[model samples]
Target: MSSPAPFSRYEFMIAWRYLRARRAEGGVSVMTWISLIGIALGVMALIATLAVRAGFRAEFVDTILGANAHTTVYMAPQRVENEFTDDVYVVPGRIQDYDAMAAKLAELPGVERTTPIVRGQVMATANDSSNVAEIFGVSLDALKAMPRIVDPQTSQGSVEDFDKGVAIGAGIQRELNLNIGDKIKLIAPEGAKTPVGTTPRVKSYEVVYVFSAGRYDIDRTRIYMPLAEAQDYFNRENVADEIEVFVTDPEKVDDWTLPLLEAAGDGAQVWNWRDASGSFLSALDMEDDVMFVILSVLVLIASMNITSGLIMLVKNKGGDIGILRTMGLTEGAVLRVFFLCGAFTGIIGTIAGVILGVLLALNVDGIMAALNALTNGGAWQPEVRGIYRLPAELRAWDIFRAIGLSLALSFIVTIFPARRAARMNPVEALRYE
Candidate 1:
């Protein structure tokens, strides 16, 4: 007679029958249920954690690149030597021909836009409230082109009125109780030279626009004014403290450093966004890797329940195994049958986990909002976490990785118990029975 093919219809039927066996019949149905649930929960947790990590990283990088420059070119410090004496004096650096320099830098490959800016720190007060603010002086065109500030979706007021007044962050507006057309007084410590000393420069400007960068710190402290106005306020007339450079890809900003330097010519230095935030990004990456490993271990532990369930099933079915062996079933067929039982549980559990995890990730924002409401607010602190909301972004790779890891672990753990059942001796098993 011809030998039966591997995993034939009879083999599947027997596996199904064994899987459906009752507790009164010495089956491990209870253990099977526990193992399946454990694996499902484990996979779900892993996928959710990965989704949050990815979302946070993406949001952070987007806020940085959207609201700030990818790279900045600053005037290098200059040393002036006295021709009559062996003395040298270091003076504050300033870019005199910023317009020409900005035009030159804009022509470099990968350069998208360049803007000359004057930056200063001042105390701003309005409606009897005060807060320290960082001011950026940029041209009307550059201010209008800014990503987060100019985005109509997140920002309010008009960019056309930017030249008439200053654009303030939402946090600043809230703290100072400011609104469009409100006058905010700016107090600068450094002012015009006088016989006594440099006096504080005090000026008040109307707030024409309000914006939210989706970051608490930025929204709380940043202010934008017309470039000419900023230059005068900061005591930088016809010159810029730095030229902000926007590139096509901020991630690849380092690659353009050399060309940017050459185009900027002498008396200039370059600082990229990575230079300011590289350590933070590195910490994020390291945390992602560590979290993945820790969650994978949890998955592996969950799969251990599968091993225990299959072992119990093998022990309970020994008598039936003896009869099947004596009836001419091959060891490989027995192994395949038992393996199918464990594999089925894993496949089902993984599918359930993927479904539940994807759903949670997609609705994380709504869930967070509900949670915050239940707790009477303060559930999520944007001031501490940097973003206004909890974010979860489901990536295909993260989902696939969770599924693959769970299933692989399930199949591996099932091997030992299946092997034991396949290797059982028919004579010893029948005698015991």
Candidate 2:
């Protein structure tokens, strides 16, 4: 063809012609198509699984960090026995001069917000349903500072409304059948000891609003009330159990730990969110990695299809290969022709699969909702399993890794079969015909 332009154009043209040929022309069209489909399906499954895992971990981390703090300063626990009874208990040392402590914490670099919290175990009863809960007593100013604790649309009631009421979590509301403005009883077991024995302190509070932190445990067990009221109920005054410090960069919490403790002065011990939830996060990460490896096996299986197709293709084209070899086509060129056939399937299939996967990842939530609808009430309800929808997040690196692996496998699997076709003795190949 006018002395072939170079870069193995002659081989490429032959490969293209072979791809377009009919089965009656000794072309392995059916096997080629099957191999392409297998590759595509394998790639799609990998992308979807990885994206879903990434999204799940992201949402869970956000929910947990939003409800808690990046770092918390708690005093050392002090054990003390009741002077009048046999009750010996360990009470956490409270932060003194909390206003100064919060101010000091806010001055630290990377600190976003600081709030004092009073936490204690309590039992909540409403509509004849009782559940043990953790109570968080926060100042109104502090509550407003934390964006996750309040919903402006729902918490737009008068100051008087919140003065005597409390905010419960969505899970708590569902568990107790509670509604806004409804009354609930809070029973604190750590009350004063009396002549009649250690008695529990009880108080009535109205539900002002419900906050959903997107975490089941926080929503189920946490309730927030005015700092003054909680202090009154918990029998603590001018003191807080800890100072919660929010940072601008939570990923660098480890770096911020020592500096924050030093800034808060001696006797202040600092711990980051990771310290409390590290194992849980690590488990999720490990599961995500395991899923990637597991799904990659699918691609490996698909690559076998490429090998099979190329071998069949080589077998069917023996006569044509002999003719090319007689016409002075080098063994390398012959190898390239077959390699292109297999490579084309892998590259095209991977690209198509990536595009389809990205589209699915972007709209996975909607897809889950639609699926649940089709399945009817209990069939595919994510809520029944404790999540609203299946989350999906596709990262560029993850996509690249998947595509690279597929193409690499495709290229590698083509080598042996292509070499075999290249080495076919011209006389042997044509002698049968």
Candidate 3:
């Protein structure tokens, strides 16, 4: 085989020689430096944006999953054919044969745990003292699984008392002025069969156990009681308001839901946290998308600097390119000279930006602390009154995307300038100088 044309050396060396010439002349102009700086900054911002979105999404989702059920199943009547329903009226809290339904669902694939949760609106009181507290009635097994409720320090005592009666939230405890031995009256509206006939009923249970879920609403106003206690208090039997299912893979809800629905047959429905908290999830998605677009625009603007620098370099090296063209270098080789320079600028900028971005993200807590001290006159402290930290999760995919976008932008800017340099007439180019 014949050796490759000498044009290959010229193509590669042209960009290198031009860069060295610029560096030797006390480096490029401030504008060229500024372009490189802009590119670097743009990439940094993009990386940061991705980290913030990923971090926040992961944290919030974890919290939601920690408290809320991964997959919830609501029983439907025989006449009800829909698999899922948002209409609370369609699937009432008093679902018949709930115990039997839970057992059947447990047999389905991917079913790790099933917890029967009783949800009812009730006004609670502590010996004439009253406060609005959310009561989540769970069986002893489910209560053990619920870390938030079972873990908080309780002066009032253990959840075993809950099986005897109801437990109030810590917030309610502070608000309603309750103690371990104190009796809190639980009033729930229900339907009961009286001597005369079936009628609406109201009943009260003493507060025996206190639980805190470590969440604002829960710690302050949530109570966990025994499932049986809730049923008796609500005058409900052989009925469960909702069944919470814990699945192996959280992302595999759709895959599990289809089969679960088939097994559940006509009346059963599935509700995921994504469905329950669509607004929050939507906002999270919007934040990520909006930031991505905005940051991409910034990168685009920054990318232009690299473009301008390359274009200028082409202009400066016109005479040299003309000589090479006269020496049998293909126009294609000349075009690649500038194109490689542009690509290198993007690659270098992206690499530097990533390093700096990671450093900033890692030190955000310290940075925030410094800013708070400087601005707030040392009036602020982190990790109390709130989480007091900015979170960032550096995802590999995000890095890949950043590199792709930045380089793609860099390569795109090379097109017109590279083409112009390659298409120049050697005679015309040399005649000008």
Candidate 4:
């Protein structure tokens, strides 16, 4: 009969030391090397991929957040105006008590900035360049926020001029050879077509500032114009696309969304960042999910090497196992000894993997920069999954997960061979000599 070792700190330390001693035999092998490298690759892939996802998500959120507010309120789509629903898709309308909406929302718990936006698409053209662009009209008072998004030197106009002038993106300026004083002609569907013909319409405005927001799409395709001018241009001064509000904390977005919607009652629909970016966020999530599964497969494949190595160890240690069984060692203790030996591969491999992954995450930017220098800066940019730096941001949570999964996988690989060693008969095992 075999006695079970007490599940104590001393017992675990004994297990650790015994396995570490013969580490050359138990802890180190070609297979162990393969396992460690495989694990490191997987963990590094995970950290880098997750970091990219976070960065991309952050950039996208910032793009929307800086230009707009945290939540947007809109008129429910005509299809379901009377029936209430929490779904975010809705039509445009100017809110009632416009100032009252802001004042009341500001009073709510955790609310920050409140603004409104009127959005439309317009086509821009210059002597040599022509492109479609997005236009946003905001209150003049919000112009104070320009520095939050753009370099202060890039544009001279403030949101105050939004009613009197407009701002063009830097890319638009570059493409069209435009300056602060250049005028742009906006071509949009001005009004519904009548039996007479399409309503004759073309609106033009002078560019007041050329602002750069650091995103290619925005820099190339967005223009901020005055609200009254846009309202006059679109002939829909009666409505706004959405009311923008900022919160004290971005993490409570969903929480505030529901209560704000509830407070607004059935008059409008509410949307958070996820609602504004639903498809984009979903695509990001799917990418993360795909990466995890794919990388986990690599780790699983590496585990096969651990399994084979353990089986070999059991075979090679038969005489040792037999002699130990003939002594005071019980089968249970013998099994633990072999199991620890096999498990040592996983433990050491995991430690190596964690170290390597952290180093990669922390210094990935330098590595990419070095690669770029080697290539002489020829059209190389870090993957723009979101942030400028190819990031591998790891939190304690991620570290814990990586370590847990790796160790668990290592322990699992030890079971079969360990059982075989435990079940061996001493006489038969020794007769092989």
Candidate with maximal TM-score: 1
lDDT of 2: 0.82
Question: Which residue runs of candidate 2 sit more than 4 Å off their true CA positions?
Answer: 1-7, 25-27, 81-89, 151-161, 373-387
Q: Per-residue CA lDDT of candidate 2, range 94-193, in tens?
A: 9878879899888888888899889899999999999889999887776666555565653434434556699888788989999888999999987877
Q: Which stretches of candidate 3 lie over 4 Å from their true place?
A: 1-13, 20-27, 76-93, 123-131, 147-221, 258-269, 279-283, 326-328, 363-390, 428-433
lDDT of 2 at 349: 84
Error of 2 at 255 (Å): 0.9
Model 2 steric clash pairs: none
lDDT of each: 0.90, 0.82, 0.72, 0.69
Candidate 2 structure, TM-score to reference = 0.92
Over 85-203, each residue of candidate 1 has an lDDT whose tens digit, in order, gives 96999977899898999999999888999999999999999888899999999988898777888889988789899999999999999999988898999999877889999999999
Candidate 3 Cα lDDT to native? 0.72
For candidate 3, what is the TM-score? Answer: 0.75
Q: For each candidate, what TM-score against the reference?
A: 0.96, 0.92, 0.75, 0.77
- Residue range 278-359, candidate 3, lDDT tens digits: 7977898988888989999998998888767777777777898899889877788788887877776777788888887777
Query: For candidate 4, which ten residues in a row score worst on lDDT?
Result: 379-388
Worst 10 residues of 2 by lDDT: 151-160
Which parts of model 4 have CA positions greater than 4 angstroms off?
Answer: 1-28, 76-97, 146-148, 151-164, 179-183, 188-208, 212-216, 236-241, 256-267, 365-390
Query: Please, what are the lDDT tens digits per residue for candidate 4 over residues 1-433?
Result: 5455544354456455544436557543555566667766766666665665565566666666665567777766553344465455444455645556666666778887677667888788876678888878776666456443455755555544555578888778888888766787778866546898767456677887777665566777888877666666776565566677788776568889777876666767887876767798789889877877777777677766777766766676778778878976677776677677657777777787777777776777688778778987642442233223344456777678767877887788778877888899999989985
